[model samples]
Structures are given as structure tokens and as C-alpha cells.
Target chain A: MKGTLIKTVLIGISLGLIWYTNSHLDIYNLSIVNNIGIFAILALSYNLINGVAGQFSLEPNGFVAIGAYMTAIFIIPMDTKIDMYALMDPAPVILQMQANFPIALLAGGLTSALMAFLLSVPVFRVRGDYLAIVTLGFGFIIRIFAMNSPAYTNGAMGLNDIPEFADFRWIGSITIFTFMVMIHVIYSKYGRAMKAIRDDEDAAVAMGVNTFKVKTYAFMTSAFFEGIGGGLLASFLSTIAPDQFTFLLTFYLLIIIVLGGLGSMTGTLVSAIVIGFGLEWLRFLDDNMNIFGYETGAHPGMRMVVFSILLIITMLFARRGLFGDRELSDILKSKRASKRKDA
Target chain B: MSKGILKIENITMQFGGVTAIDNLSFEVQKKEIYGLIGPNGAGKTTIFNIITGNYHPTKGEIIFGDETITGTKPNLVVQKGIARTFQNIRLFKSMSVLDNILIGFHNQSHYSYLEAIFRLPRYFGQEKKIKAEAMAILDEFDLTSFADHKATDLSYGNQRKVEIARAVATNPSLLLLDEPAAGMNPSETEDLSTIIHKIKQDFDLTILLIEHDMKFVNNMCDLVTVLDYGEKIFDGKPADAIVNEKVITAYLGDFTHA
Candidate 1:
């Protein structure tokens, strides 16, 4: 108990420092940092199922789209004109007063959670690759539905003029809270049950675990956070389009978890920050590069190419991933002992 | 006579015209070590599976403590105070031995997901109490030293002990152990017999076991049932069961040596 408190305090202090720096930094750097924090939450949400809970689900993008659209519908002033195109009718009288950033984000999360609950009833019945296919289909269905819903979502034209609900301050606070909550959960008895189910379903059932119920609970909880992440992304950009929530986004989240290691919360945290910011940094290579005597000016698909190479390398050499199921505290403890020996 | 805790009547389990347990009927009394002994392919394990709710009886009624448990989910059967260990050791390979036992306490633990998330007072209280209880159970089997090790890393005898530890952790009124001494040295088999007796006394449990070891069965069981070709040939006291002509014939094939 004391150890947990000390850990929580240290995390609170570190988060406070990051929030202060982000708020005071230059605009360009602030945007990058903010995005890194937001994506960290998104990737961590994905990790709840893929890493900790041991179910490979490819529906982060679907939940994100739900969050984004819900946030837009709730927060974006319906009366606001978008490029001379009046997107939605004027805000309802009740909503005009109730439309706040936090409330909208909460609604987004709740909406996604409800969707996940409904979807998991059928989807979680299957295992392994079949489960992946079901989740992938869900993402496509969500995107296609968003594309076709012109009245509510503005169709392919997209919803714009959304209020900026997630700046550096909001993302940083929420990310820290989410990360702590995830860590607490993974260390709990419920987390042990989840891993037991993942390791051996039959054995887990014999041990009195209702594997189906555990899987569904994990799925819905993950979807809730993914929804919050989606809302943050939409609020940051002030616009949302169906194309943004694609398989590619889910692919990125998967890469984050793999780079971190499955079933490792600390691994997810480190990988999320590194990959989130690292991808942004690598964008420079896409725009300016010289190959032998030729100038490769910002190759269009450089990010994907670099990511694919990194993934292959990681899989081949470091299959356990960066943290390999160990948390940051575990790494720190091991490092401290080694440093003490060296000293 | 003590009331029967588990009653299975006219149970017939079939697989594509092959009857595994045909018209099987039995009742296990409270606090008795009931042994089910049968030759190879005589369907002893199949009966255990049926009683534990793994396989639905084609036509039978299973009443446990006055409630029908046939065709119930395995986890619900466990929650209803019926626990079992498999013939093959089925410990969660990656989990610590202690955690494996804690998993048996899943239905008993009252902490909610929220309580766990926040590490609430109740969560800590329940966890600490359960951990202590789990350690005590391990201590009973002399498994405290190996509690932190992965269950799969244990030796065959130790693994068997761990499996039993996990089963009894559910605090069940009735326990089913399938071939508890199947592959063990004489010393290990003797130790397992002692542990089984100790556990039944300590937990006040009614145990039903399937074992092929004749010496172990005659020594440990109060009453024994002998099965041949999925048919019960004898059901009586272990001494009587050993002397029954049908059981001797089933065991020694003609009973000339017996």
C-alpha cells in the first residue's frame, strides 16, 4: 500500500511537470507534445485488450470514429458555418447550454462503450483470427455508416467547426489519469484473471472464471477509453472525417502495442510516447531525403515504409517487445541494482 | 444413513452410437471417500465429466444438494460447491502456484472491478485475507516454498499436489479427483494418500476419486465401485469389493491368480 502511494505521488509530480512544460512551450512543439499524449491514451486503450487482456481486437478506429462524431455532434455549434456550408441545424436549445468539452467527451466515451457492449456479445464468441476479422469488420461498418449518415454526421463532407476540447492541458491530464487507471487495473486480481483466461481458457474456466464475462468486460472498458481518445483527437483537429478512422489507425495502435510488448502496460506507455512522437519526427524524412545521387523529396508513403521496417526488425530481433511484460517500475528496479553494482 | 450429496440416476452418455456411460446410477454420501475403479476404456473419466457438468447426460437426472446441476456451465457447477481436478494436470502454466489457487477463489471473492481499480479499502482487505487463506491451503500441502514458482515448473508429484490445492481452494462440500495417484513413485503415492485423507478431514469434504492403483484404493476408500465395460459389477465396502468374484475377474482376467 505504501509502495503504491509513493508510486502514485511520483507519477503525479512527473505529470504535473509535463503539463506545465506543455502549456508554456512554443506553439509548434506544444501541438506535437499534445498529439503524443493523446495518441498515448489511444494506444494504451488498445493495449487493454491486446496486451493485458490478451484479446486481439482491431476496432480502435471504430470506437474512435464514434467518439469523434459524438463529440462533434455535442460540442460543435450547429449554427457555426463551415466554409459557407451550414453543416448542422442550429444547436438545440437544451444542448446550447449543456454543450461543454468534458460533457461531450464523456458522452463520446459512453456512446462507444454502449456500442462495444452490443458488438462484443457476438464478436467475442469467436477466438483468434476469427475474432480479429469480426473486429475489423466492425471498424469498416462504423466507417461506412459514418460515410452514409449525411444528416447526423455530414457524410463524406465531414463535420467541421468542432470546439477545441483537447489542448495540451486536457490531453496531458486525461492521459496521466488513464495510464494510472490502467496500471492499477493490470496489477489487480481481475487483471490476473484476464491473463489466466488468455493463457488457458479451459483451465481458467475450471478455476471458476467466467471467461466470456471477463472478455466482454475488458472489451467494453477498452472501448470506453478508445472513445475518449477519439473525442480528444476530433476536438484537437476541430474537424472529423470518416477517412481518418481507418484500418491504418488500428494498424498504428497495434504497432504501438507490439513495439511495447503484449501484456505489458509499462511497455505500452513507453512505446506510445516514443512511436507517437517518433512518427512525427520521421515525417521530416518523407519530405527531404537524398538517395545516392538522387533527391527523394518527401516520398509519399515513407512513414508506412519506415514503420513496416521497424515492425519487421522488432519482430525478428526483439519479439518480446520493448518492456516484455515488465512495467516501468520493474525496469527501474532492475536498473538501480545494476547501477549499484557498477558503483 | 447420511443424505446423498450427489445423485446421478439412469445417466446415458453417447457419442455417435457409442455409449460411454450407459444407464449409470450412483449416489455419493456425505463425508465419504467413494472410489470408482474401472479397467481401461471402462468410462470412469466420462462419469466424472458428466457429474461435474462438462457433458450433458443423454437421459438422466443429476441432483446435487437438492438442485439439478446437469448441463449447467462448469463454472456454475463450481460455484454451486462442486470442484474437480483433471486426470491430466491442468494448472495455469504461466501463473504462480498461489495465483492458481486464488483463481479457485474467484467466485468467493466479493471485490468489484471498481474496487480493484481504485485499490479501495475493501479490495485490500479482501485481497489480504484471501492471500492469507491461500497460503494456509498451500501450507497444508507443504507447497508454501513453491508458491511463487510457475505451476508448470513443478515436478509431476508437486503438480498433482498443486492441482489438488487449487480444487480444495474453492471450499467445496464435494471434491472430485480423477486419478490422483496415476503416475507416482510408491513414496509419492503414499504421500498423496495421506494428503487426501488429511484434506478430507481438514475441510470436512465428501470426495469421489477415480484411481487404478488397487493398493491405494483399498487403503484409502471407505466404499468402492467397480466398473467393467461401462457396467458396474460391484458396489460395496473396499474389502468386499476386493473379494467380489466379478471384480477379481475384471482385474486379473479369470481370477485364477487372485
Candidate 2:
């Protein structure tokens, strides 16, 4: 009951902030906030498969690409589709289809989920480094497939003019809902079964848990959320390209989850928001400068260099991330106990 | 004269050219504690593996309570009312003791994932019941104090008991214990023997255990089967099993040719 109260109050505060930002903030600032919300969803979903399930899978980029393309294809206006695919003849059935925002999002999630389910049959047969390699290879394959297929994805030029349905409210509400569902799952029996498989697969099987089936369920759910987050990103940006969904995108989410803490939902949320906003905040590092009239000039990838250093420092100092698999609730309870004792 | 709860019929397991178990057969009656005693590499654990579907027999079938369960996967085998512990403790080392036991109830949960995520009535209702049942098991076994500790935090004897407690939580009709008293001291071994016998009565379970300890086999087992290199050498009451020449030769080595 107490937890429910805390959750509701926190959600209300977030909604109030989102409403205020949507009304008063500039478009650029609003986009950064939206990025934080979207990245939080992506990182949370990634953590489910990689951290909580202990699969160490690197397939989020592939699933996210599926969502981006699926949303772009289904929601782009018929006239916009004709302009986008004019270089090559547009695919007949998918051309000019204008789905509502929710339908497009659902379609993207379901299609990505289907792809993940099919991939799991072959992919889950291998584990650890081999699974990582296969998934990494699959991520590249998705991008390359998009690049070569002009009809569906408009080849290299990519699709633009996507509908902007994912504003502050949509992103904020979905972020809260996704975050809540994941937390609920972590405390559920199915979540226990997933953790059991993570701890010991053979023992979980011996304990009457269907290790394969439970893992498949987790993998599919993770894909569903990643797809939805990806679609949200595309809709919010009003543009998307094959290059947008790369292994680098997967790496960014990975860094956030690692910096936050594996198996910690709150840690992922905080770290994703910090890194998401930090990326935008640090973009001045890439700007050409005449600092002190020296003409220092723009450094193309300076932001990433600093980001990589930050990640290395974090790995060295806090190897288990900020939370170390313990939650805020655990820390808060301990603090309250210590305060009572002091009194 | 009565049909057994578990019947291993002509179980033969081969790994390449080598046969781990060759034409081995045994019967464990209901509500009885059966002992499978064998020399090292005699395929005792192999039999357990076959019965629990970790491995399938090359040349025969396992019938548990009238159903022929030959090559069913390990998870379904447990759901079919059979559960087991490993030769070396295989508890989830990072999880709490209570969590380890609660996982044993994984198949027993009837709530859907939606129900769990939404915290539906069935979710809370079932979870409360499961938690109560798990706590009762802990209390009954005097493990209530260690319930919050990591499973690996316990002493070796306590770990062994916790494994049995977890297996029992699965609510199985037949329990397979692989070397339960493996590293126990004499007192611990005696305690385990007493507990096994008592659990057989209390849980209404058919227990088939592999033990190297002759004292445990002699004291706790209602019926004993002796294996020499995956072949059944003796099967009878412990009193007769100890004196049987073939059983003696299997353990003491054959000197007739010399």
C-alpha cells in the first residue's frame, strides 16, 4: 500500500513536469526530454533481456530497426510514401497506408516480437559470447537489409516526414507505464522463473520451470518494448534512416544500463535519463570554436571520446554500477532504520 | 506382490561405444525408501539421470505410476510428480534460501503473466498461499531462521537438507536424491537417514536414493538394490543384501579366479 502511494505520487510529479515542459519549453529542450523518456524505455527493455534474464544478448538494435521500419511503412501518408519511394517503385500493399498512432505502435511491437520469436529458435541455441556474436551479426544484417531494400525502406536515403504523434505526454505516459510493468514483472512469479534460469538453467529446469519457454517469453517481451520505444523515437523525430538504428545505438543503451546497474530497474531509469540528457547537453563539444581567438575548430567525435572515458571511469570505480543490483527501496529502508536507531 | 510406484525396466544408456548403464532394472514401491548402492562409476547417477529425463535410456523405458515416461524433458518429468536434487548441491547460489524454495513452486502457479504484472486478485491470492506454504515448510524443518540467508551461506549439512526441502516443495509423489549424505559427518549422516525415513512417511513420498554410506543404506532403506558396473547384482531386504555373495563381490572385488 505504501509502495503504491509512493509510485502514484512520483508518477504525478513526472506528469506535472511533462505538462509544464510541453507548454513552456522550446522544441529543442522538449526533444531532449523526449529522448530521455524514450531512452529510459529502451534501456529498461534492454536490461530485462541482458541484465535480469542474464542472456547477454546484443539484439536490441535489430529489433529496434524492425520497429522503426514497420512504423515508417505503416504510418507514412500515401502521398508522402509516393515522394519517399519515387526513386524506386513503392511496394503496393504497404504504400500510402495511414494507421493511427496506437495501431502503428502496436504493429511495430508485434512485428518486432514475431521477428524475435523466430530468431530465438536459432539464436538461443547458442549462449554467452557466441550468442553475442550472432546477435551482433544479426544487427548488422538488419541495417544492411534495410540499405539494400529500396522498396520497403527507401534504400540508403531513408524515410522522412514521419507523423509526430509522440510528444511529451505520449512519451511520458508510456515511459511510466513501461517502467511500472517491468517492475511488476521483476516481483512476479514469471520474473522469479527468469531469474532462476539466470542463476542456474539446469536447476531451474529440474525445479519444473520450462527454461526455454520462460526465456522465450522474456525475449519476446523485451523485443516488444524495444520496438515500441523505437517507433516512438521515429514518430517524435519526424524522420528516420537506416543508419539511425545501428549497433552504436545498441551500445549507447548498453552503456546506460551498465552505468545504472544490471538487474536494477531504478538504476537503469536514472542512468538512461542522465546519459540521454547528457548526450544532448554535451553536443557543444562537437561545435567549431574560436575560443580565446585560437580557432580551436570543431572536433567531429569529441562527445563520444568523453563519453567513452566516462564509461571506463565508471567501470573502474563502480564495477557493479551505481546500485550494484540493490534497489532504492533497500537503501531507503536501511537509511530509515539507521535514523530511528540514532533517535 | 503389489505394483511399484516407479519401475525402471531394462534401462540401457550408452555414450558412444561405452555403456554407462546396461540392462539395469529396479522397482521402488510407494511410500517406501529404496536404496541404490553401487561402486564408483557403476552408473547409479546415470540411472537417476534417465529416470528424471536428463538423459534417455538407449534401450528401455521408465514407468512411473502406470505411465511410461521414457524421453520426456526434465521440466515435464517434474510436473509429472517427480523431483530431484543433485550429487553436488545445485542450489541457485546467489538467491536467498526462501527464493530457492519458492522457485520449486514455479509449475504450481496458475496465474498468468498478465495477472502477475497487473497484480490481479489471483496473483496476490496465489502468492500469499505459496508464501505461506513455503514458510510452513521452513518452520517445520527448523530452517525458518536461515530462510533469508543465501542458499550457499548454509553449512554443507544444512545445504543438503535445504535441497530436500526444496525438492519436497515441488509436491512430488516420487523423490530422487543423488548422494544426499555425500559429505556429511557421521552425526549428520544419521540425522539425514532419520529425516529421509521420516519424510517418506510424512510426505507420503516414494524415495529412491543413491548412497555410498553402508550404514545409511542398512538403517533407513526398506529395500536395497545393488549395482556392479550398471548391472543389478542384488535386490532384497538390507539384511539379506549385506550377506549376498554377488553384492559382496561387487563392493569387495572378486577373488574366485585368483
Candidate 3:
């Protein structure tokens, strides 16, 4: 209990720092911090399926893209919109409502969730690598469909001039809210069913778990949050494009979950924040660093090569990842006891 | 007239060219311990699997509580008040013991997705009540002490107890336990017998168990059915079934004197 209190205090302090930084910091720093908050939400939301539910999914980027386009359609100013690739006879009636940030985010999430429900009927029966391939195909299909559907998504040129409504405070608060709700669900009875399915599907079925239903619930819920994260990203950047939500984004999210540890919520949270900031921090070295007298800037893909190598090493050495399914509370408890002994 | 809880009529399960269970018929009366004993590969487990909806019998009709539940999904069968444990311990290894039992309470739960997501007052109320019930069930098996521990971290005996406790948490009218005492020591087997008796009396459960432990089966089961090569050799009182020459030969060799 004492350890929990301390951890809560620490989280409060960190959140306070983020709030202060967002309000008082310079524009560039604020933007970087806002991006971090957006990715953090994306990572944590993806963790619901990939981590806590013990399912490998590559569809977060697809859901996020859907959210982004939905948000762009809803939140962008109608008067300022230019006809870059004007496929619509006129803008749809729902897009003219001028919704606020929260409503747009919700719309994005719900839309993505609906898509997930439609897709999961056939996809949930397949397990492991097959499931991953199916989801990856779904993500590609979403991107390709967005590119081809000139009427709805503006085709190849993509939608632009989306209104920027998500500031640092908004994204940060939503991220924290998402984290709290996810943690609660993870500890709840339904969460137990998800873990049971993850651990042993056949055993769970024998125990009377409606495996398909539970899996569908998890997939849709996770997709909803991922969509919201995507909406935030589109709003934050003031743009929506098919290229932004690609297989690379899915790969990065997978790295975040694996680095955090499969089924570890706290691990996902920590890894997201750390890797979000780490990716930004490494940008400084991209232009200047040289390895074995070879200019790194000459090879633009070197960064991802290094990143992929790091992931492979992490997998080989620490197959369970950072926390190995231990929650933050468990880690804090041991730390507190060790601290007391040292003192 | 009190109807039999489960009526298996001419259930035959075929795997490729081999028949695992050939025209097997049985009935489990309510509130009784039905023992199924057979030599290895006699298709005892296959019969259990067929009844539990794990496998669709090539040909058969299974009537549970007057409903034709033949080839129904396992989860639906469980919701119809039939629960089972595996021959091997199949507890959710990563989940806490309490959580493992709580999974059994999934179909019984009334909370909706919204309630669970938002942690509404009704959700909390149901959660608290279920936690208490799970603890009570665990207490019966002396497993309350390990409630917070992962199911896999427990000893083999404790894991077996956890599996049984989880099965009971489903509140099934008919509980099928496959080799519940497969790996227990003598003392553990005795304890399991007592636990099984207490559970049957407390929950009003009709149990059907496939057990190799003759002593445990003899002590707990009132009636026994013997099987040899997917065929029933005897079905009668435990004493009568044990004394049958075919059953003795199936267990040991064909000994003229013994």
C-alpha cells in the first residue's frame, strides 16, 4: 500500500512536469512533447491486444489511419478546405457539423471499432502468425482503399489543412485516462478471460469462455483506442495521408510492445514514453554520425536497420522483454523492500 | 420422475480408420458419482471429450437435461451447466489462482462490457461478490493461501486442486473430471477424495470421472463402468465391477488364481 502511494505520487509529479512543460516551453519543444503523448496513447492502446491479450496484431496503424481520416473530415474547417483532389460532389452532411476535438476523436474510435467488428468475424479463427498476416493485410487494404477511394478519402493527394485541436494538455490527459481505464480492465474479470484465452485457448474453451466473443471484444476495444490515437495524431499534425499510416508504423508499435514485455501494461507505458523520446533524441545523430568512415546520412535507412538489429538482440537475449509480464506494482514492491534494507 | 442429467445414446467417435469410441451409451443420474475405468487407449478420454463438445462424435445423440446438445460448442455446453477439467492440468498458467477461478465465472457474470470498462457501481458490486465466492471455493481445497500466486507456480497437487476449484466455480450441475488424481501421492489422493465428496454434497453436483486410481475411485464412486477396447465390459456397483474377471484381466494379466 505504501509502495502504491509512492508510485501514485511519482506519476502525479511526472504528469505535472509534462503539463508545466507544455504550457511554458517553446513551440518546438511543445510539438515534440505533443507527438510523444500521441504515440504513447497509440502504444498503450495497441498493448491491449498485443500485450495484455497475448495476440499479435499489425492493425493498429490501419485503425489509426481510419481515426485520422475521420477526424480530418469532422474537425477540419469547411471554408478553408481546398480542392486538392476533389472527388466529392460536395462535402458530406456529417462533415459539415464542425465537431470539437473530443467528439471527432470519439467518432474516429467508433468508426475504427465498427471496422474491427466486421473484419474479426473471419480473422479471429486464425492464430499467431496467420492472424498477424491477416491483420497486416487488413492494414495494407485500408491504405490501398484510402488511396483508391477518391470520393471519401481524397485519393492519392490525401486530405490536408485539418484543424489542429489537440495540444499537449489534451493528449496528455487522454493518454493518462486511457492508461487508467486499460489498467482497470486488465485487473478485472473480463481481463482474466482475455489472459486465459491468451495462455491457453483450448483450456479457456473447456472452462466455458466464449473465445471468439472475448477476442472480438478485445480487438474492437483496442481498435477504438488506436483510432482515437490516430485522430489525435492527425489533428496534432494538421494533415491526413495514407503514407503516414503504413506497415512501418505497425512494425514500430510492435517493437514498443515487445520491448515493454508482452502482457505488461506498465511495461508498455514505460517503453512507449522512453522509445518515443529516444526516437526523437536519436534524430540529432542521424545527420552527423559516421560509422567506419561511412557517412550515415548517405544511407537514410540506416536508422531503421539499427532499430531492427536492436529488436532482434532484445528478442534473443530477453525473450520476455523488459518486465517479462511483471506489473509496475510488483516491481515497485520489491524496490521498496530493497530500499528499506539498504537504508 | 427425475430425469437423468446426461444421456449419451450410441456415441461413436472415429479418428481416421480407427474407432475411438464405438457405439458407447451411458447415462449419468443427478447427484451421483459415475466412475469410468478402462485400460489405456480404451477411448475413455475420447468419450469424455465427446460429451463435453470438444469432439463431434461421428454418430450419436447427446441429450443433456432433455436438450439435444449433440456437437454443441464447448462453451455453450458449459453454459448449459456442464463443466469439465482435463486429464492434464490446464489452468491459465499466467493468471493468479483467484483469477483462474474467476474465468470459470464468466458465463455466470451479469456485468456488461460497459460496466467492466467504466468500473461502474454495479460492476464493483458484482466483482466483490464474485471474489468472495471464489475465495470460498478456494478455501474448500485449502488453496486460499495461494490465491494471489500464479496457477503454474503451485505444486502439482495444488494445481490439480485449483483446476477442480475452477471447474466447480462454473456452478455446473454435471462436472466431468478426467483423471483428477493422476499424479497425487497417497495422502493427496485421500484428501482429494474428501474434497470431491464435500464438493458433491455442497454443490449438488453429478460427477463423472475417468480415474486410474482404483482405491480413490472405489472410495468415492458408488457406481462404476468398466471399458475394454472401446467396449463396455461391466456396469454395476463398485464392488461388483471390481470383482469382474474382465476388469481384473484388463488391469493385470489374465491370472487364473488371482
Candidate 4:
């Protein structure tokens, strides 16, 4: 009952935040708000696998791509199906089918999860950097499949004309839903078992934890949310291509989680928002570096250089990331206890 | 004529060309505190490996409670009422003491992942039950105060205690303590002996212990066996095993030649 109450209140607050931002902010800022919602889902899901589960996965981009393409296929308007497939032939069933935005988004997420399930069977045999290697390979494979499977994915031309059915409200609701489920799972016995596996696999196994099963479950679930996040991005951007879901995109998520402090949920939220906006706002650096209105000339990758410098500074100073495996609620709880003692 | 709860029948564990445990055999009776002792690399741990399903013996079988358990997985072994601590401490370093213990009850947990994710009534109900039960176990081990502390943050003695507490929380009928008193001070070892005795009686558990702490082994174990070079050198009463020439020579090299 308490969990449900807290969840409803959070959803209400998120909805209000989205509505307020939409009405009050300028177009550019509103778009940032949308990016924030999408990034929250992506980063939080990634955190479940990397931070909380301690799996060190680097394949969220592939999962996200699966979701984006699947969702784009469903949400593509009926009239554009022939034109969309003109570059390559879509399946006969795909041409005849049309799903609502919500169903399409759900299918997109499930597709990513399905792929994760298959990938996990082999990947679970390896741990540490080996797991990362296999997962990275999995991501590359997905992207390559998207590139070559022109009959389905339109090759490199990518999917356009995707319906923008989801707005700020939809994103907010999904974010809240995703956050609530992940939080509950984190606090449960299932989550504890995952953490135990993370801390020491042998110990966890001796303690009766099915480490392989738990690891696979965590990876698959994380992939599910990554897919949803990518689906949302597709609708928000009204376009997506194979190039958009690269290893660099995975690196961007890693930065968010690292800056947020790996296992901390609120930290992920804060860092995702901070970095998401920072990425867009820093585009001025790429356009033409200006300090006191002195142009240093345009450099296409200058923004990335500055971003890399900031990440280096963060690593040098705050190696454990912002919250260092702790959440804001932990600090609040301590403060409340201290105040009570003083009183 | 009395039977044993566990029977290791001609178990030979060979790794590559080297036979770690060469045709070893032993039996542990129900509710008996049995001790296995040896010098380093005598295949005492190798015997443990065979029992814990870390190795499928090259030949022979392990019969526990009338069931053959020669090649079970570690997780399944725990579910079959067998739990063990490591020779080296292996607590989940990043988790709280409570979580470390709570996870030991993974096989006992009734709620599904779906229920846990949704926080359904069954989830909260099981969580509360497990929490209360874990707290009770912590209190018994004098670990309740450190329940919220990380497993690695505890003192060395407390970490060992936490590992044992976590193992016991699995509700095993047979508990294996692999060098449980390895790094403890005298007082800690003294306390551990008492804890082992108390748990054996209170939980109706049979214990198989591997310890170099002779005093602790003599005090707590009902039967003691000595192993040297992968072969059972002595098996009898603790007093008899301790006084046996082979057991003595195994620990201290023979001076008769010199």
C-alpha cells in the first residue's frame, strides 16, 4: 500500500513537472526536457545492470536500436508503408499491420529484451571484461544487422516518417513506471541476490543464489528499458538511423552513470539531465568556439573534446562518481535520524 | 552397526594427471560434529571440493541422507540442506550484513520476481518475515548491531561471524566450516567453539569442520580424522586421533631418523 502510494505521488509529480515545463519553457529547453526523460530511462536501466547488478554491460545502444527500429516499424503511418519500404522490402505481415503508439512502444521494449535473452545464454559464461567484450560485440552485431537488413531496416537510409504520438506526458508516465519498478526490484530479495553476485560470485553461489539466472534476468530487464528509452527518442526526434545507435551512444550512457555514481538512482537522474542539457548547450563550441565574442573557428568534434576533459576532471576528483553507491534518500535518512537524536 | 548420514565411498578426485584426493572414503553420522584435519596440501580441501560439488570425482559416489550427491552444483547442494563457509572469508563485500544473510535464504524465499518487482502483498509479507527471521539470527550471533553495516566494513572476527551466521541462515541440516577459526585471536577462537557447540545442539545440525586450531577441534568435535597426502591417516575419537603416531608425525616430521 505504501509503495503504491509513493508511486502514485511520484507519477503525479513527474506529470506536473512535464506539464509545467512544456507550458513555461521555450522550444529549445522543452526539447531538453524531453531528452532528460529519455535519458533517465536509459541511464537508470543501464545502472541496474552495471551498478546495482555489477555486470559491467556495454550494450544498451544495441538494445535501444532494436526498440527504435521495431517501434518505428509499428508507428509508421499506413500510407507511408510502401514508400518506407521502397528502399527495401518490408515483410508482408509488417506491411499489413498497424499498432497504436503505446503497443508499438511496448513491442519495441520486448524485442530488445528478447534479444538480450538470447545474448545472455552465451555471455553469462564470461565475467568482467570478457562480458563487456561479448556485449559490445552483440551491440555491433545489432547495428550491422540494421545496416545490412535493407529488406526490413531500409539499410543505411534508416526509418523516417515515424509518428510522434508520445509527448512530454507519455514520457513522464513511462519514466515513473520504469523508476518505480526498478526501485522496488532494487530493494527486494531478488535485487539483494544480484548485488551479492556482484560482490562475490562464489560466495553468492555458495549461499544458494542462482548467479547465472539472476545475471541474465538483470541484463534482460535492463535491455527492456533501454529499448523503451530508444523508442521514446525515435518519436521525440521523428527519425532514427543505424549510425545513431553506435558504441559512442553507449559511451554517452556510461558517462552519465559514472558521473551520477554507478548504483545511485537519483544520481543517474541528476547526471542524465545535467549531461543531456550540457551536450546540446555545448554545441556552440562546435559551431565556433567563442570566449568573450572571440571566434576560435568551428571544429566539428570540439564539443566532445571539452566533454572528455570534464569527464577526466570528474574521474580525477570524484573517482566513485557523484553519490558513490549511495542515494539521496540515504543522506536524508541520516539527517533525519541525527535531528531526532538532537531533539 | 550404526549407519551414517553421509557416506563418501571411494572418492578419487584427479585434476589433470595429479590425483588430489586418491580413493578417499569417510562417513559422518547424523548430528555428529566431525572434524577433518591435516597438514597443508594433504588434499583435505580437495575432499571438501569433492563433497561440495566443486569436483565430480573421477570415481566413487557421495551418499547423503540416502541420496547420491556426487556431482551436484553448489547452489543445489545448499538446497539439499548442506551449507559451507570458505577457508578464506567470502562475504559479499558491498552488501549490508543483513542482505548478506538474507540472500542465504534464497532457496527458502516464497515470493517470485514478479511479486517482488510489483511489491505485492506476498512480497511485503515475505520481506517482513525474512527481515524478522534474519534479525533474530543476527541477534543470536551478536551481529544485530552491524546488520545495516557493509559486510566488508566489519572487523575480521565479526566478518567471520557474519559468514557463519549467513550460512546458518540457510537452515542447513549439515553445516561445513572450512577453517572457521583461521585468523581469529584466542578469544575469538574460544567464542567460536562455543558458537559451534550451541548451533549444533540448537539447530539439530551435524557439522563437518576443517580447522588447524587443535584446541578448538578437540573441544567442539565429537569425532576427528587426520589426513596426510590425500589419504586418511587416522580416524577415531579426538583424543585417540590426537595421540596417534601418524597424526603426530603428520603435524611434526618424524625425528626417529635424525
The docking quality of candidate 2, as DockQ, is 0.73
Docking class of 2: medium
DockQ of 4: 0.86
Worst 10 residues of 3 chain B by lDDT: B249-258
Q: Tell me the tens digit of each residue's lDDT in model 3 across A1-343.
A: 5745975897698789768987899998788778778877888888888777787788898999999998888887666554544765434663464788889899999999999999888888766576688889989999999898876778877888877788887888888878877877787777888889888998899888888888888888889989999999998888778999899898888898889888887888788877777766766555656779976565455566667787899899999888877688867865886687699
lDDT of 1: 0.84
lDDT of 4 at A18: 73
DockQ for all models: 0.64, 0.73, 0.77, 0.86
TM for chain B in all models?
0.95, 0.96, 0.95, 0.97
In model 3, the runs with Cα more than 4 Å from the true position are A1-18, A86-98, A125-130, A289-299, A333-343, B1-3, B251-258
Please report how far candidate 4 places residue B164 from its true position, in Å. 0.2
Candidates sorted by DockQ, best first: 4, 3, 2, 1
For model 3, which pairs clash? Answer: A51-A263
Residue A150, candidate 3: how far off, in angstroms? 2.6
* Cα error, candidate 2, residue A198 (Å): 0.8
Tell me which residue pairs clash in candidate 2.
A78-A96
The digit string of per-residue lDDT tens for model 1 on B1-258 reads: 799999988888898799888788888999999999988889899898887777888889899989988899888888898899999888877677988888888877788988887778988888888899999999999999888677888999999999999999988999999999989999999999999999999999999999999899999998888888888888888888877889878877984655
lDDT of 4 by residue, B55-141 (tens): 789999999998999899978988998899999999988777998999988878798888987778898788889889999989888
Per-model TM-score on C-alpha atoms: 0.92, 0.93, 0.92, 0.96
- Candidate 4 on A31-50: residue-level lDDT in tens? 77788889889999999999
